[model samples]
Target: MASGKHRDNIKQQSKAAAKKSGNSIASRISNSFRNHQQVAVDSLDRLLASISGTLMIWIMIAIAMALPLFLLLFLQNLQQFGSDLDEASQISVFMNTTTEMPRLEQLRDELLGRSEIQNVEIISAETALQEFQASSGFGDILSGLDENPLPPVLLVTPLAQDAAVLQPLLASLQDYPEVDEVQFDLDWLQRLYGILNLAQRLTYMIGLLLALGVALVVGNTIKLAIENRRDEIVVVKLVGGTDAYVSRPFLYTGLWYGAGGGLIACVLILLAQLILQGPVSRLAGLYEGEFALVGLGISGFFMVLLLSAMLGWFGAWLSVLRHLRAIEPG
Candidate 1:
């Protein structure tokens, strides 16, 4: 009778333990869902409050990005213009006046074998005078002057378009015994290249300074938010809230700030670009150029957005950690 009673007691104990386990699991799941909802609500509320500041953040980012973008585009156009001018970057290689036309023709033929040189226009004295008269619109003045003073020249164009490479090539061509002076308008292109490099370096330096400024701005803002909610933080501590629970909302707030600011920056940049587009097009048309500036593509847009959000999050996290520890007991 006692053995049977013992078996029944064991069964009852097992049933009670199973029921307790099931209840605990249900309670945990309910609490987990509730916490998720609470965190979501908290994050959303903070994000709304932060919109105005976030807008300012994005505007700053936009300005920083836009300056570099415009400068880069202008530099690209400058390089393109140099390339276009390359067709005309021809060197006027004047032959030694003593060299006969036949010998000059022989020399031209010999030069034709060189792969580095583009097309060569052999301008005889009469042809040079004629071209100068036509281009200068000085036909009437030239008709009055009985003497034709222009010399025979070979307009030598290099196949390569870069100013750096062209100068060395010109030096090599000038070494020829039959060649006198080699004249080329290489100054403008060289200066343009130099200016472009300087501008790029300046933009990079400014960008670094501005990025640091952004991080500071975010940090200060988070610090202020933390200060404002001192009592609320105290209440959370009294209510047995874990540090992670208190910190999650602020972390979310930072994420939102970065993402929102990044968005605003992108919008501002596009708006600025749109505003400038008409004037740019008109200017390009005046120069008879088909060049069009490119804006940031989809990948670039996403990258900027991601970076902004990340920065904001990091700044907020840094502030929260520094302050949260100070709030707790030693």
Candidate 2:
């Protein structure tokens, strides 16, 4: 009976000890989180205390971030405009002046039936002459001609914009007896594509350089901050504070700077878009284009904020690791 009682007592003690251990672990985790939270809040308060200096840093970072962002937005809009032009691209097939209306209609139908062609629009000789007269502002001279000078034309929209496909199609059209000339102006289209590609490359290069600039700016700011708080860091270390504990506030400070800069950059970009909207609309109107300026939507906005915060954190981390090691309590 005594042996059984002793076994029961041992089991109860083990259960109690396990419970106490679990509670201790939970308490430690809670304390760690609370400490981090307090540190982060305190860091932000310090930044707020010197609003002028903080604002200056934020503006510098924002300008650096905004330059690349603006270039990217411009490139996106330009690409969209280029796509619009690409979709409207067509081959002009001028028929022989002697070609009859019936032959022109038949040729258009045949071109439309081809797998490579998406659409074919026929402009009768008389209609072409009238359009030319209206556009050229030489209506009197054109009307005095005994016979219509313009030939019937077919505007052929191809299914594919690839040069390989378009070149063959152009050659085939030229072989047709009714075709006086097949003009696709492939060179201009190719040049447009080349220009867009070059622009994209330039944007990427500029974005990379600007991103580096942002990181450097943050790092330099953090370095200055470390210098200002040199005595505080040395005191903390002397009191047996861990490196992480000493560095937590600075890390948070960097994060605040980056996040603030990101926010300011967003504002700048929006303002720029608004300022340019009217001019862009008017210009597009002049070109008979229905293009509208696009801004960083919700996803892009959040992404910028996140990226800026990351850069700030990285800069702070680098600064802390480099400078904290050199400071000794002795």
Candidate 3:
């Protein structure tokens, strides 16, 4: 009888212990959820506590991001113009007025036979005179002249529009005795492309510097936050809070800072684009160009936000890791 009673008592204790364990697990989960929620609320409160200072930092970050973005957009537009110019590449070779007709014919045949020359159009002096008269609306002024002042010319298109190929061909053509002058219409295109390349490098350098600046800003802010909550951290440590628990709030704070700055930067970029769109469109129209100003579409918008958030998170993590170890229960 005693043995049976003892077995029953053990079973009862086992059931009670199981229930206690379950309650403990439930309590822990509830506490964790509450802590997370509180951390988020505190971070938001911190942001709201210093609205003016936060705005100033956000604006500084926005300007830093905007300058590079503007330069990149300018480079894009310049590249478009260079692409158009390249497709229409042509060299004008003007013959000496005294060059014989047979020599001119020989030169044209030679250019046509070369593999580098894609197409050639020969414009006679008389034909050029007639075109000028028709296009210039100066028929009356030209009718008084007895002789056409224009020289015979050849408009030559190359198989390659690159400077490497065209430059050599231009030099070779100038060596010809019948050639008076060779007008390279694409020199400015090369120059503009070179400038764009330099500008792209400058933009990259500037972006790197600004990214470092952002990291520094976030780190410093997180460090100050740590200092402000020093006693609370010490108390939490005394009560057996883990390092992860102590660091969560600061990490959230960094994320908030980064996200806010990214949003402001995007706003600045869009505003600048809006202000410049009309002028850019008008300028393109003047050149008969099919060009339009572009902005950070959906992909770019997400990218900016994601990058900023990562920077903020990393900065906060660094600060927390370095400083959390210094705070102890003692």
Candidate 4:
């Protein structure tokens, strides 16, 4: 009976101990969150006190981020424009002037049946002459001619725009008895591809370099902040403050700097887009095309903000890791 009573007491104690442990953990977590909130607020207040210097840092970061962002946007737009010109990649086949309509149709059908060709459009000599007359302001002169000089043309759009595919197709088309000329100016297309590739590489290189610059800029700023607060950090450590506690405010400072820079960069990009939109639209209109400048939408804006914040945090962490240890209570 005494053993049973002792066992019951032991179980109650065990339950009490477990409850106390859980409460302790919850308390620690809550205190940690509160401490972080206070540190962040203090850091922001300090930055607001030194508004001019903070603004300078933000401007530097903004410029660094904006250049690559603009280049990326330009490259995306250029790629879109290139895709829109898929029809321009077609091969033009001018048939013999004496070729009959039936033979022209037959050749078009044959080309369409091939796996390499996506589509074939045939223009009869009469239709071609009529289009030329309408555009060339030579209707009166053409009417005085003895007979139609234009030949029926076939526009063959290949499934692939690669030079290897196009070259063989051009040769085969030239071999046809009814085809008088086969024209595909591959050089310009190749040049465009090369230019796009070079631009993409340049954008990547510039972005990497600028990203490093941003991190360095934030690191330098954090270093200065640490130096200014050296006495305070030493006092905190002397009072048994942990390294993490001492570094928290500075880390928050770096985050604020990075976030502000990202916001400014976004605003700058938007302003530039607004200024350029009219001119770009006018240019597209001149080419008889409809195009609108695409800016960073909601998702992109949030992504930029998140990236900048992470960079700021990284820079702060790096600075704190390097310098916070060197500052001793003594």
Candidate 5:
């Protein structure tokens, strides 16, 4: 009976030890989670504690971000306009005035055979002269002439409107023996495309500059916050707090600033789009176009918000890492 009792005590002790170990681990995990939650809460409190100051910084960041975002939206709309213009682009081929009717028919057939030409249309000299007379009010003066002075023309529509493709095709048509001239307003289209590309590059340059400005803004704000809490940081260090522990709250502070600024920037962009929509729509109508302004969709919105927060976090981390080393327990 004594031996049995001894075994019972040993088992009880073993069970108690297991339970205690389990409880210890669980408690540690709970505390770790709680500390993390506390850090976030404290960071939010810090932001709220100085509303006016935080807002000023946020507004600055928003303005910086909005400029680049607006430019990007404008470029996207321009690309749509370019696409519409591409569809309307056409090439005009004027035949030699004295070319035979059979050769003209042959030229038309050759153009139709090429894969690059989408459509071919013939404009005889008689039809052309009649059109000129009807519009120019020179009917009686032109009738006195023995024959029509105008040349037959071919209207060639290409499969592509891009200058590179059209240029080569136009050159090929000009090489035909029956062809007199090939004329296309490709220079105007090329110039428009060049301007659009320049604008896009400029927008990128501006965005990069403004992003740097945002980082500096956040960094300066974090530095001030750190300065304000210098004594608190020193005390924590003296009490055996790890560097990571001391920096966690400040890091959160930066994140709050970045996220808040990004949200404001998005609001500004949306408001701009809303206010300009009617005006833009009317302008498109004036040109007989169905153009509509496009805003950053779901993915884009979240990307802006998340990117802002990341920049803020990065700025804050940089500031903390730089300034914390200077702070030590005396």
Candidate 6:
């Protein structure tokens, strides 16, 4: 019985050993994954702490980047508004309601002769007043007016996309003996065009300057990271760690800086848009336009994220290459 018990004990010991070995291997693999993930986060923390004024630098860059980016997106909506105006050449002419029908008929015939004219519709004062009443939310009040009072209006549409025709047409119409007034609210369109042009140019300039800020911030951050890990790096190189191995943590550091800054930029832009959206939409509503504030589309968001990550990665890589050689203990 004693010998049988001993044999049983031996068998039990063998099974326990196998389980222990299996657990050890599994634990090692789990630990490796944990270490890999932790390394990146830890490196970022260490790097961030090492860099003096890094937080301030990143915030500054993000704010600068968001400004023009916001303006650019806002102007994109304006461009869409112009698209709605495509079909209507948007020419307005005013004539005295007392003008003879024959003269108005002759004016129409002359307009039809112009090759540059596509479609023309004339609205009489009565029809114009009715339209105004319906849209003004004062339909009941408008009926109490003494008379329609509005003058006869001619609305013109051009055949060509070129808006320059309005100038020549306006000159001719002003000279017409029967014409009282020729008007095109070209001021709004022209002002919008000027603003859009300025936004585009400013966008580029802001982008360049902000990008330089990003590069400088990242570079300085990586430099500080190198200085912080001087002792650890020296020991790492002394212990047969490859250059690649030593560089990994610093590279991750820069990536985190850039990525963090980019994320902040995204949030800032979105927040700013949100804050301004209500007022902007209310103003547009007053003008009879359904102006919905649009944000940075998916592609643009991704590109910005990519640019930020690249900036950080390149900055870290540069720091590692430049400083790591000096960190080796001969």
| Winning candidate number (lDDT) | 4
- The residue-level lDDT of candidate 1 at 71 comes to 65
TM-score of each: 0.63, 0.69, 0.65, 0.72, 0.72, 0.58
Candidate no. 3 TM-score: 0.65
The model with the greater lDDT, 1 or 6, is 6
Residue-wise lDDT of candidate 6 within 1-330, one digit each (tens)?
Answer: 999999999888966865877756677679667866887988767756856666775676577667667767777877777656654546788888776556666778789789877766778777889899889888887798887767878787766544476667778878876678887775567566667778888888877777777777777767876898788888988887778778888787777778777777888877877898999889988989777777876787877777887887887777777877778686
Candidate 2: clashing pairs of residues: none
* Total colliding residue pairs, candidate 4: 0
lDDT per residue (tens digit) for residues 1-330 in model 4 = 999999999888967876877756677788799999999998999999999999999999899888999998888888777767755788889999999999988998999999999999999999999999999999999989999999999999999876677779899999998899998876676678679889999999998899888888899889988999999999999987988899999899989988989999999999999999999999999999988888999998998888887788888889999988899976
lDDT of 3: 0.84
> Which residue ranges in model 6 land beyond 4 Å of their true spot?
1-38, 45-58, 84-87, 90-191
> What is candidate 5's lDDT per residue for 66-176, written digit by digit as tens?
899999989888878887887767788898899867887888898899998999888899989999999999999999999889999999999976667877998999998
**Span of ten consecutive residues with least summed lDDT in model 4:** 17-26
Off by over 4 Å in 1: 1-45, 64-87, 97-164, 228-252, 317-330
| Candidate 3: RMSD to truth | 9.1
lDDT of 6: 0.75
On a 0 to 100 scale, what is the lDDT of residue 183 in model 1? 88
Reference-based lDDT, each prediction: 0.75, 0.88, 0.84, 0.89, 0.87, 0.75
lDDT of 5: 0.87
Candidate 3 residue-wise lDDT, 169-208, digit = tens: 9999999988999998777787877788888999989988
Steric clashes per prediction: 0, 0, 0, 0, 0, 0
Which should have the higher lDDT, number 2 or number 6? 2
* Residues 103-150, model 2: lDDT tens digits: 888888888889999999989999999999999999999999999989
